[model samples]
Target: MQDNLPIRKIIHVDMDAFYASVEQMDNPELKGKPIAVGGGGARGVVSAASYEARKFGVRSALSGAQARRNCPELIFVKPRFDRYHEISKQIRAIFYDYTDLVEPLSLDEAYLDVTQNKKGNPSASLIAKEIRERIFKEVGLTASAGISINKFVAKVASDYNKPNGQKTVNPEEVLAFLEALDIRKFYGVGKVTTEKMYQLGIFTGKDLKQKSLEYLDTNFGKSGRFYYYIVRGIHTSEVRPKRTRKSLAAERTFNENLSSEIFMLEKLEHIAQEVSRRLTKSKVSGKTITLKIKYSDFTLQTRSKTLPYFISDKSIILETAKDLLFQEKLQNSVRLLGISLSNLNTEKTKKKLEEKKAVSVQLQFEF
Candidate 1:
């Protein structure tokens, strides 16, 4: 996809608290209160929780009981997948009004390559905002947008202003914005890498850029090139709307059956560093961080942490994995451990004005 001279104009549309917001929009009385979708049974999981629920630590994937514990006044609702999908289809159809390079990630999100938009509008951000407005007026939903020169920055920028808020990442300011960013916030750094970066004096974009390619290559091998590229805002990665992820993780299975906290931590840290490096080299980030452990009896325990944000940093990845590890009950001597990353990154678009199409990150995530 990168071989051509096609500098594609792409947009990523993400529904805000999609399921919860849908419930709230459908029932005005549910607005402004803690709401969670999906609480039918023991196996029932929270599909989406409102901002109010978020304040109480209620979140998607949490058991119904856990969510109630987090927020006593939380209101639970069932998922309307069919309805949500219908809304998604309606939103995607709107994309067709602009371009055919539309790729749907799910019922709540999609990436549209509007480089040669059908409307010939010349402004992806304009298209993004218009789409949001259309979704609200037609489908009765709210969305957030992020527009930028590339899919990576655009998708990241979308989250900056969410729940109907819009933000733009201008080409001239992309560098400074990235420079001031925390190392952990980078698309591929992961949790372990973030901590290591802290230990190695790499806290921000400037620190990451300061590290010579030789140093990064020596330490991180293939990802060294990517590190340099992103720091300079020189990414050449293409946005293929139809791409799916492969090999989501790279971790180690401990060689010995031991449980020394410090030692185990060191081992996980090393694994996270390797994984982060690999992710950057591959130009990917996983929203799910999985932890695998096997006991001396050959019994296995696995845990996963799904992030609201797509990340590729080792430190964040490791931290989440570590938390998952602690969440589980260990019954025997630790003999093995593994880590994997999933829910990879994809293209996203934003709402932008026609004149600001050159480079703009949609800051629209307000509800």
Candidate 2:
């Protein structure tokens, strides 16, 4: 049904091994080493792995023990989230310079709806190139970018060439590109779905496009239509930030490491005030409070506690953050601290959905 909808120009930018790359960039010493960030312990999972590590059968979510077995000299560095966040902000600023239609997927990935842009660059490929160059020059890291007429194809194109790579599927080439792709390469198709498609003799975009719409709908429900359209290089949904926040977070880095409990509590009071204000503005109350901490050596960790009911009071936020901070074994002086709230009330979310629907309808009428 959405295939009949208007077309949109989209770009997907995915930073290659973001955490590991940041580590490599900051300390040239780590550049060529098989590097991984997160989970040095036997049971912990890897959050990111460098291209060097990826060559040795290492990847994000692999257990540290297994990764060690694969590459004995794998360098494990604790994440420096504050610095990473700063880089993310810098990169995102570059996106906004071209188009306000930026949708942040995470600290390292985003979708840009550059149907209309500040630079008036008619080709999305050129935009992706400029953005990648800006990220490299400004952030001291490299990223891969993909451009297409729609999100699904653009997401796939971005991964086609990786680590300082960029790929573009122009309007004329959309159908040909999708037709040649393996069904598994589709953004939403996972291993399980690919297996199913294989059993059904669906291997390529042409195979998927040949399936009757009714049959697809009966088999895959709402997602069937989505699959049917994307296989033919069609996705009408515009690039958008998922504004629904189950969590809100803000953190601060102090010029000097905190050594005194009294001073820590005073700083938390200010953070709590800011977090509470954000919660109030969103009209959302959270049942969970998360405290993020970074030590002097750049080691980072998080502590979270959930309340029985949602809360948005400054005093409650301050008390919870303080409690979590004190509970931690403070072996090192804290250099940065942050408080976040999550698991918001559903009633407010329902209202937001209703408002979003009205806005969508209004936009349709205006168009």
On TM-score, the leading prediction is: 2
Off by over 4 Å in 2: 1-5, 247-284, 287-309, 312-367
Q: Over the stretch 1-367, how does candidate 2's per-residue lDDT look in tens digits? A: 2446676779999998999999999899998999989776655568899999999999997978899999999999988989998999999999999999988989999999888999998888888899999889988889999998788888999999987899988777888888889998988988988898898889998899899888788877898888887776667677875555678877776757887666788889998999999899878889899999888787988999999978999999999999998895776888788999998876766688699999999999995
Question: How would you encode candidate 1's per-residue C-alpha lDDT over 250-329 as one tens digit per residue?
Answer: 64545457665456787788888888997898787778788888787868877887889878887898888778877855
lDDT against the true structure, each candidate: 0.77, 0.87
Per-prediction TM-score to the true structure, in the order listed = 0.62, 0.71
The weakest ten consecutive residues by lDDT in model 1 span: 346-355
Model 2 score (lDDT): 0.87
In candidate 2, position 97 carries an lDDT of: 95
Off by over 4 Å in 1: 1-7, 40-44, 218-224, 244-367
